[model samples]
Target: MPHPRRTVMAVTSASLVALATLAATGSPAHAVDDPPSTPVPITTPDGALFSYVVNADTRQHTAAVKRAVRHAGGVVVQAWPQIGVVVAQSTNGDFRSDVLAGADGARVESVGATRTVPVSEGTPGSGGTTAYAEEKASGAGRTFDGSLVGATVADPREGEQWDMAMIKADQAHAVTDGRKGVVVGVLDSGIDVTHPDLAGQVDLDKSVNCSDAGKVDESLAGKTSLSGTHGTHVAGTIAAARNGIGIVGVAPGVTLASVKVVNDDGFIYPEYAVCGFMWAGLEGMDVTNNSYYVDPFEYYCEDQPDQYAAKEAVRRAVAFSTARGVVHAAAAGNSGTDLDTNTTDDTSPDDSTPVTRTINNGCHDIPTELPGVVTVSAIDQAGLLAPFSNRGLEAIDVAAPGRRILSTVIGGGYGLLSGTSMASPHVAGVLALMKSQHPTWSPAQLVAAVRAQADDHACADVTGAPCVGTDADNSYYGEGVVDALGAVS
Candidate 1:
């Protein structure tokens, strides 16, 4: 099964109410000095530490909030004034309570810990094995004695890449292979920058790792520290080089930037996500591909103080990025639950022991459910909805090939994988193509064009319940499979 990815808050009822009111209404006026042009990292005390996002009324309130954080025995780790969200850590287990009770808390909107968000790749064996291992297992290289060789092969496997032709990317390439000016940020584990298919296609200058304290560390860019190949696969699907040596991407001409967010253990935290989005906006990236969900809680509910704070901080970061013209694309998840209907979430608080709870539509998958995000579902080779893909008319904005996808992986090899994770990069690549063709178009305009150009796919009658919605729009197919030719033209 697609294991739920793993990875807290303190506030009084009255203070919570006040913060809720602040969220509803605009912040009160207050002034402080300007924040640094770049994020400044602060060290936290040793011990069991917790991450928190302190929402301020204004940039001027940042100093006061910092002071309050210090007085409360907490340390400021990173400050993002562009969205008025601060990343802080403290050994005090009651950091949230202390901040809310302090004088500076009055100037803040909400303070909650940065929850863990794991990058879910769907069921094991669903996407087959890792590309590197698969190639070696299949004896991709055989010596004269019939023994398997460990040497890498230069197989592009172009004919097997049906997903490319399904979206008509090959035909679209003739019209425009994408522009060099356009860039797509792959916000996932990390990319194999040295791969033959992605060597010159990566923009190292724009790439950075945001896996810690919401600070952008250029030194960590393109480094996968772990053995995971998810980020490399995603990057290949988006902008792998068209060197006629390996698999070609939807927009092979566009540039890609690796925004490493997933840690060595394959977990994605809130701080990393926030930093990735903020950095993308600041760098003027045309589109961002989000292949995972922020974890700890699969659905962040408003009734829960900690979950509410995480949602608010992420929502603000996404809004800030979208406003800057970065089109955000995320996976719809592999839970197979209908997002439009009221369903119970049994995998919440994934960082610890998961508790089965009866959750309704009020609880949402952050980023995917947030406003202005381009949510993508998965489809199989025959234009059928993937069994593992989450479906809902309300949350799904588009559909793309995701099952048994063949793409570049680490070690300059190729392999087959599946999940909504694979599906998201397809849409992100199309967005890049569209951006290249229409450089002056806004994010809203690009989204509208993407949805409008899709080829309609009707739901099929299969096991369980039949598909819902009409041909115009449906819970399974969204606006139908994305069309690359249509996107570029």
Candidate 2:
């Protein structure tokens, strides 16, 4: 499968000045504030579907909001009183307007559709089966004779795991394999619990699929019944067991819980994402790895009410999760553009037709650019930035090996894949180790430790253009490559 390229626009100095002027004054005349006023009744780009994330004012009772939602021809899917947010769905065309009218003084802070995010697949030739074969043939499969850095390594394919070695996780394992009690949530397509490499390490009790609006179905958790391998691969990278069968993960002794949020079509809706994060907090998950971008818009701008509501819902969920002690890690993106600068997006409102619009720093990639999340970029085996990895000094926190990485896939199979998606798990696995070694550390402390311990890489010269930032911290390499040994020690 080809990785979905993030839609981006290069901004000129003129656009930047225009945006600054617009910011100082008011929104541009072309900016959209209200939906069309026609009584024809507007449906989603996909016709007749209505879903919303409604934030209740602090003074309003959640039960009253539920009644309002019902009166407006919508059903309250879930009521998260902790964050004052509610997920609702309706088939009525005038659902938003009706909800407001029915609620009257119920204090609805915001209401918008549950946006959609497409699956972020790996790009071909960057990493996949072909790269796996070449690395295997180039002596990467050399036997370790059951010992590495003074520890007995049992997994047969551990020798082929160049990514683990690159981050010194193989050496770190000698110090501590990890504590079993620490749970890392894999929020992606789903995991394959039956895989030998991940058998005993998966926490089934905490796993749930939030694909449906109001249900928590465990049966939906795990590999997609229709050939999805992303989640299984991610799980293996975090806690694949040391059973001498496939490969060992960075933190082999930790537990993995699947919070399946993506659907069969590989799209992650905002409702599912909100549920996953909220669940992680309630379940006391120590960490989570998010490799996909939330969609409908790549960069949700605050000035746009529709986009702002979606961003606010996600932000509240993440904030709730963070306050409850979940360390969140996410991929920067595969766009290969600088996130700190002005850019235009041509792929937003993806649930329907996309329209090109200019965006500045005011707009952001949800969860990644959100506060307190550890944003990670991708580096190749040679410690250089991956050609497709997103870069931003303000957004990226660390870099990890993502190119041509190998791990467990569906059906007890092993394969290679690449992307910033591949890089995120390396950092997640390291966080698991850090959590195991220092259970009392808060999420902020863990993030600081990871950044402080990363191996500093100076900016690289790419395609006759010099990379940005210094060796200590740069847009391309962040705080440099993640070091598992440093994390564990």
Candidate 3:
């Protein structure tokens, strides 16, 4: 962003030196808990398949864990030795306990059923065995060369993009649209590549459907639900082309990888999320934007063994991405509450009946709350914090224009959507610009620069919610509203 030239993490193989290293790291202390209860609440009905994550202590011990999974009548769908995580399906209600109690049990760290509902996508066969390998070998998605010589800078519908002006993306665009190779993975509902504005932006080879037990499907399609345009909307905000046909994105010169993690029921399960993150690293993504939290639980607590194990598996997958130099940005949430002083959760086990369970400091929002991820909150056109955004003096890393954002929707058209989900892509776009400018900068350096360059402001009094901290840093605004122009200048 500073118009500086530096070293580059250019290619996929060159980008992936430490996937094995991340897998080699012994299990985290938090994952080494005692045996959890068998037949965890909300388990599948007998003979009904449920997806689970079986984690071993390290990559070297994954074989034993795989054997344990088979012994418990579960079929290993996919085994990620790099993260010591195995995505499996089982009809046995006691698979969770049985997998961690036999002779090979000591080699395993923890086992967890990733969701509350029975498998809707069905169990694994051997067809998906080469999907990931084939995808990696096929090629990457589309990327811009940052050339504006004959390109139209102003899109036909850009007049409707107030969010761009709010974040100063308009000013940044004059400096540079972005770079040629930066790929931002959109981990959400599947993005529609056929959309006029996104056809040239989405990387089809890099995109995959992870909703089916973390299996990689090369023939990826759009969202299964009629109401699912979330991924395409977020992609438009990040890198929709600057063609005359439609609205432009914040970093129109970058590329997008549509990593579908949301299911037909509109849920983002832990296994899907883990697969998305891992795919980002394996595919050599520069950044990833997570607009939703893991399903069924608004908060995954460290004390709950099942929750902890599932969360830990996801964490390991994210760590693998980070180690490969992938920067991550995530939405804080739309619950309209303080994540710093979390109290109660009435939205857990969303696949089933939700109960108002008392929560505490041990609880957390996955991905957004995970280490090394930039947590963003939502704001409106007036520069006021969105009332529905989750605020936190501890959790939030930045703020961005989110409410009533105009971007590409599913019907090969444009629409307005809100929530922190819309805000995160703006940050991801800014990060892409930063990477394009300073290709060799470490992820930490980029994050620090983004924060330091933010437009700091006092907390908004509009929400009537308590605003803590000074203008420089506050619960409602984090460092402040993300400054696109500043990030690139």
lDDT of each: 0.73, 0.72, 0.77
Candidates 2 and 3 compared: the better one by TM-score is 3
Backbone clashes in model 1: 6
- Across residues 234-300, which tens digit of lDDT does each residue of candidate 1 receive? 9889987666565788988899988887765555667778888998999999999998888656676
Number of the top lDDT candidate = 3
Q: What is the TM-score of each candidate against the true structure?
A: 0.84, 0.83, 0.85
Residues 1-489 of candidate 2: C-alpha lDDT, one tens digit per residue: 211112112244644554454333322211232122111112443235566877665524566767777887777888888887788877666666566567442456566666432122212222111111212111122222332322355677888899999999999998888898999999887887767677677788888887666346667423233226787777888888776667889999899988877665556667777888988999999999988777556777655555656777788889999999999989888777778763667655555555777775347787788888899998898888888788876668999988888888767778888888888899999999999999999999999999999999899855533467788998888898999999988
Which candidate has the top score in TM-score? 3
Tens digits of per-residue lDDT for model 3 on 1-489? 210001111223322332232233322222122222112255566788898888888789999999999998999998889998998999998887788777688777777777776877422221111011110111122333345322765766788889999889999999989986999999988787777778778777787788777877766343332226788888999988887667789999898988888766677778889899999999999999998888767787654656767888899999999989899999988888888765678766676666777654446788888888999999988988888888887778999988888877776777777888889999999999999988998778888888888989897676467888899999889999999999788
RMSD of each candidate? 9.1, 7.6, 9.8
